[model samples]
Target: EFLRNELEDSTPVIIMSTAGNESNVLNAFEMGAGDFVSKPVSPSELLVRVGKLLRQRAN
Candidate 1:
């Protein structure tokens, strides 16, 4: 996968698909994604996920 090769370390990626499809999310994960967000996403949800990922990286 490109991400697996491109990313130097554990990088977090947030994906927004048209619908809440598991395939896209799974593929991202398989490609070394730290997180995946499906579409119809809320602002609050995005904020939370971003915050969580940042916090996780900080720790």
Candidate 2:
């Protein structure tokens, strides 16, 4: 898998998708995504999530 092979462990993957279903969101989490944002995404919300992830990584 790309996450296992290509991505560094510290890198947080946030999936922004329009599907917004529980199954898809669960799949992303199972595959190592740090956070999931459903589409029609607000830029500010995305930024906040990104900031949270970054802060987590920093810690």
Candidate 3:
């Protein structure tokens, strides 16, 4: 999060973690995360998320 703030760049950050608590997910977004996925992540889902964010970024 500190790095995200410091970099001042538009690159997306997607957090994948085993901790699926609502607070953690919300906090990540509050800190500028583009997306979050609880673990045992699916490759297909991850790809979809990346595609979505990328499409938004393109705009």
Candidate 4:
């Protein structure tokens, strides 16, 4: 529902989940997610991913 409403491509969506299976990751991408992070995320890694997305969005 959130994705459906936020399809204007302004806010980049990142999916973070414990159930990080292949199908789930694929589903997120198919639903317009900009990135996906699995459970037990490292702060630095998450920051990097977010920064990368933000940089891409800015460009």
Candidate 5:
């Protein structure tokens, strides 16, 4: 609901979850998520994803 409500906002959202199912992922993207990451997250990968979103927003 928050994602849908804030769809027009400039700030990006990244969904992190242990339950990384296809349905949930698609739903999140459909609702305007910038990225999604599965749990047992790697610090480097998270940083890279965040950096990518930041760069995209900058453009």
Candidate 6:
């Protein structure tokens, strides 16, 4: 799988999906995604999540 192959590269992925469709977010988490955001997404929330993920990566 792409994720497995890229895991060693320390790649981060963000997945977005409707509230009712949680599978995509779950899959992304299973694939080692750094974060997941659900829609209808708010600009402030999106910025916060992205900022958190970036800060995580920096540490």
Q: lDDT winner among the candidates? A: 3
* Candidate whose TM-score is highest: 3
Instruction: Score residue 13 of candidate 4 by CA lDDT.
Output: 83
lDDT of 5 by residue, 1-59 (tens): 47457555758889999889999999888878899999989999999999999999999
**Backbone-clash count (model 3):** 0
lDDT of all predictions: 0.79, 0.87, 0.90, 0.87, 0.88, 0.74
After aligning candidate 1 to the native by TM-score, how far in Å is the CA of 36 from where it should be? 1.1
| TM-score pick, better of 4 and 6 | 4
- Cα lDDT of candidate 1 equals 0.79
lDDT of 1 at 1: 58
Q: Model 6, range 7-58, lDDT digits (tens) per residue?
A: 5666556777775366766777787777877778899998888888888889
Q: Compared with the true structure, what per-residue lDDT tens digits does model 1 show for residues 1-59? A: 56668666666777777765777778877877777877788999999999998999899
Better of 3 and 4 by lDDT: 3
Q: What is the lDDT of residue 32 in candidate 6?
A: 76
- Candidate 3 local lDDT, residue 17: 90
Tens-place lDDT digits, model 3, residues 4-47: 77887778889899997999999999888999999998899999
By TM-score, the candidates rank as 3, 5, 2, 4, 1, 6
TM-score of 6: 0.71
In candidate 3, what residue range of length 10 has the lowest lDDT sum?
1-10
Candidate 3 runs further than 4 Å off: none
Assess the local accuracy of residue 24 in candidate 6 as a C-alpha lDDT between 0 and 100: 69
lDDT score for residue 24 of model 1:
76
> On lDDT, who's better, 1 or 2?
2
Q: Candidate 6, which ten residues in sequence have the lowest lDDT sum?
A: 1-10
lDDT of 5 at 6: 54
Model 2 lDDT tens row, 7-46:
6464888998999899999988888889999888999999
